[model samples]
Structures are given as structure tokens and as C-alpha cells.
Target: MARYPTITEIAQKLGISHSTVSRALNDHPRISSETKQRVQDLAQQLGYQVNSSAHAFNKGESKTIGVIVPDLSIHFFAKVVRGIQTVLDQHGYCTLLFDTSEKMESEANAVSKCIAHRVDGVLAAISMETTSFEHFLKLSKHEVPLVFYDRVANFIPVPKVISNDYQAAFDATMHLINSGCTQIAHITASINLNNSNNRLYGYLDALKSAGMEIDEELIHYYHLQPDSIDTFIENLLTSHPHLDGIFVFNDYAANYTVNVLQKLGKRVPNDVSVMGFSDEPVATHMTPRLSTMKQAGDKMGHLAAQKILAIIQKQEPMEDEKIVINPELILRESTR
Candidate 1:
């Protein structure tokens, strides 16, 4: 195995004390300019890299942030991670990314790893199966600052960066109503999730505001099952043949819903209009492209990163706070 060149090796080669070499490498004010140049030149020639762990140990900080996401495959989450990296990189901090794959057990293990790594801070989005928040609360005991984005625990007294899911869903449903869509259906995620629950409430409220009948059968609580979507749509069309509009919580599911609708001999925006959320890449890739609400994933990520950094730096206190990003409506061929 190739051994990494260290400052001791550099000092031995330059015939100087290791302390002088270290001071020169760090550009200490007491170090002379000539010594600094020679040390830097020799270090570069020898391919010597700074030991970040030792540097962090001396400073009593990790200089690293842990980011935990339920699913990295989702485009929105990937964009959020990119946004976080952009901010963290600017501040000379590195990221440790963890994907929980929507499993509570994986999320718990990721939290343990973050604590073991002694990260300066953490940013997380709870998984679908995360009903208990004990794992997240453990971070507080270790004095590790934590911030949440998107899927968050409402009871946790920490900063949260989130989209205005309720307003977005309400507006989407109201748009369908304005476009002459009566008897609209809604597809949402698990009830345990705060965002999905808010969206479901928004959909219901829109129908009530428009004086349309609120049919329980029209609302489907999707649980990450593709075949369930088909069953719901098939049963829905059979029970309510006049269904005209469908609002889904996500673009990927909306795309699947559209495919199912087509398979059932329904024409999008003609026989049935569809609206989706998050404006993911799948929205445009699907035939007859989807009309959706655009959640600012990158902006949310930036806010979460900033909040955690502030907390870590003691510029702000870690308390119960919410920073909300309002979503924009993106109209396309999927809806009238």
C-alpha cells in the first residue's frame, strides 16, 4: 500500500523542525515569507495533503456536515443535496451523505453513524416509516445541531425548511375547479407524513370552498405501491365515471397515474386532467406533459444549510422555527 506523505516527511526532506514546517504550511503570521514558499513548493512537489481530521481535532470541530435523505433517487432530493453542497463548499465544509431508502431502520442507523463521525451538524428528511423520532432526538443529547427539510417531525423543537404544501395543493385543486373540472380525484402519500396530510386537507378544503361534493372515495392514500394506483383508478372510474381531474402529490406518481389512465382508454386534458407536485423531471418526459406545482428544493436546502450553520456557529439558537417556501404553479398539457 502506498503511504501518504506527511508533514514530518516534508520536514525531514527540508532539514527543518516539524513545528516550523507545520507553521509554514498553515501560513502562521510569525512564519517568514521565504520559509512559507519553500514549504508550500516542497509539499506540492511531494503531493502532501493536509490532514483534515487532525486539523479538525485541534480546532475542536469536525468541519463536516451530515445530510440524511430518505431516497436519493428522487430528483427533488438530489437537487436539494446539490444546493446544500453549493453552500457548504463555499464555507470550506465537507458533506457526509446518507440515503435511508425510506426505511426507518436505515434512518436510525444513519443517525448513529452521524453521531459516531462527530459531524458539526446534520440536515435530514425523515423517512416514510419514521413514526418515532427518538433517533433524531438523540442528536440533541450529543450537542449535534440538526435541521430538517421537506419531511420533518412537527413536534421536534428544531429549525425546519419546508414548502407550503397546503397552499400549493389548494391552488392546484382550485385550478382544476376553474378549468371546469368537477368530481376531481386526489392521490396522496401515507397519512403519517405531515406534507401529505396537509395536502389532503388542502384538497378537501378546495372542494368545500368550491361547493363541490367531497367524496371520500375520490381520495386515495398511496403507500408506495404501483399496483394500488391501478386498482384505485379502475375502481374510481367504475364507481364515478364522471371523474374529470386528478391531483397527485408527486410527479413520478402522476406520470404513473397518467399511464394508467391511458391504459384505461382515457385521454389526458380531454377526458381527465391531471395535476402533480414538485415539478420533477418526469413531469416533462411523460407524453402530454404534466401540469404541476414547483417546490423549490434547492432553496429549501440552502435555507436548511444556513440555519444549521448559524446554529453551529452560535450566531443563532436552535429552537422551534419554520422557514417556508411557497411553490409556483406550472401549467402544461396535463391539465386544462
Candidate 2:
């Protein structure tokens, strides 16, 4: 087997000191451009690569950031990761990604691993089961900079990048009301999530603004069970036969709700209009394309990455602050 090339080998071939090769490879300002180029040329020719672990040990900096997401299968989170990579890659930092599968236990374990690895910083979107943030607090005790995005711990004193879920939900609900929907139901996610709670408030306020009665029965708090949606729709239809609209918190749930509505012989838009949030890909692929609020997942991720980087670089201090991105309402066949 061919052994991997080392910095010492590159230095020997270039007739330069290993220190010179190291500085040149790192693009240190003290290294002259001519020598740096020669060192780089020989290193590339020899298939030499920097041993990041060793370099991190020597410098006491990992140059790696930990990114924690509830679920990687979600398109919105996937886009957020892409946006994070776009920034981190340009700054010579790699990411250690953790998919917590929307479970609090997994999220806690991921945090432990990040701390064990001594990551330079962390960006996280809390899982649905994350009602308490004690696990996240461990990172702070270790002095690791953290930034939350999308799903967040509201009480945590750290930077958060989030969409204006309240405004988006309000606007989406108002759109349904303006389209002649007198009796509208709502489907929201786990009550533990701040975004979901904000969306619920927005939905409620929109109904109140329209002089409509707030019926507690008309609102369904979804708990990630598809079968529950079926039961909820069946009961909703029986209780309120004239239900004309639905505003859901996320696009996937909205798509599922639409399917359930169709199975119950209700025609979308004609009988009931449906609006979803996040504008995920599933929204467009449905039979009647879903009308939704476009939450900029990529932008949110970018902003979160920038915030963590700033804190890590000492350019800004980590504090309790929020950077909000307003969502855009996209009209489609799902709504009138």
C-alpha cells in the first residue's frame, strides 16, 4: 500500500524547512509569496494533505464547527445545511454534522460528542422533543460558541436566527380569510417548539382580527403522527361540516392534511382552501399545489453560521438576540 505523503517529505523535496512548509501551506502572512508558491507546488505534486487533527492539536483550535439539526431528511433543514457549508467552506472550516432525528436524547448525545471533539463552535436547531435546554447549556459551560436557528430554545441566552413565524402564520391565515374562508381550522406541530407556538398565536390573532369566533376544537396540535391527522380530519368534519379552510404549520403536514381531506371526499379549494408554511418541495408536488409561506432556510442557515463565526472570532459577543427573516407568501392552487 502506498503511504500518504507528509509535510516533512514536501519540505525535503522543496529543500525548505518543515516550519516554512507549514506556514506556507497555512498561507501565513510571514511566509513570502515566492516560497509559499514553491512549497504549495511540491506539496500538491506529492499528494500531501494537512492532518487537520494534528494541526488542531498544535494550534489549540479545531477549525471545525458542529452543526446539529433535528432531521436531515427534511428539505428545509437540508437547505439550511447547504447555506451553512457555503460560508464555512470559504473560511477554511469544516463542519461536523449531527442529525438528532428529532429526539431529545439524540440531541443530548450529539451535544456531548461536539464537546468531546472540542469543536470551535456549534449551530443547532433544537428537536421537537427538546422541551428543556439543559443539554445545550453544557456547550456554554465548556465555552463553545453556539447559535440556534429555525427551532430554538427561547430562554437560552444565545444568538438565534429565525423566520418571523408569527407574521408568516398571520399573513397566511389572513389570506385564507380574505379568500372567503369563514370557517378555518389550523394544524400546528409540537407545543414544545417556539415556532409552532408563535404560529398558533398568529393563526389565532388572524381569526380574531376577522371577527371570527376562536373555537378550540378547530385547532389541532399535531404530534408527528400521520394517522392522527386522519382521525383529526374525520372528527373535524363531523363537528364542523362547513369547514372551508385550513392553515398548517409546515408544508409536509399540510400536504398530509390535504391528502386526508381528499380521502374524506372534500375537494381542495372548491370545498376547502389549505395553506402551509415553509414552502417545501412537497407543497408543489401535491395534486393541488399548496399555497405556503416561503421561509428562507438557506438564508437562516447563512445568518446562523455568520453569527457563530463572529462570536468565535471575538468580532461579536454571544448574547441573547434574535435575527428574524420575514417569510414570503406564495399563492398556489391549494388556496383560492
Judging by lDDT against the true structure, name the best candidate.
Answer: 1
TM-score of each: 0.95, 0.90
The residue ranges of model 1 lying beyond 4 angstroms of the native Cα positions read 13-16, 27-41
What is the lDDT, from 0 to 100, of the residue 275 in candidate 2?
A: 96
lDDT tens per residue, model 1, 1-336 = 989999999999989999999999989999999999999999999999999878996899999999999999999999999999989999889999999999999999999999999999999999988889999999999999999999999999999999999999999999999999998999998987999999999999999999999889999988888789999999999999999999998999999999999999999989999999999999999999999999998898889989999999999999999999999999999998
Q: Judge candidate 1 at residue 295 and give its lDDT.
A: 91
User: Which 10 consecutive residues of model 1 have the lowest summed lDDT?
Assistant: 51-60
Off by over 4 Å in 2: 1-3, 7-46
The residue-by-residue lDDT of candidate 2 on 1-336, one tens digit each, is: 969899888888888898988899999999999999998888888888878778786888999999999999999999999999999998889999999999999999999999999999999998988877888999989999999999889889999999999999999999999999999999998999999999999999999999999999998988888788899999999999999999998999999999999998999989999999998999889999999999898898889889989998999999999999999999999999
Clashing residue pair totals per candidate (backbone < 3 A): 0, 0
Candidate 2 weakest ten by summed lDDT: 48-57
> Of the candidates shown, which would achieve the greatest TM-score relative to the real structure?
1
Model 1 Cα displacement at 226 (Å)?
1.2
Please report the TM-score between candidate 1 and the true structure.
Answer: 0.95
Deviation in Å, model 2, residue 21 alpha carbon:
8.1
C-alpha RMSD of each candidate structure in angstroms = 1.8, 3.4
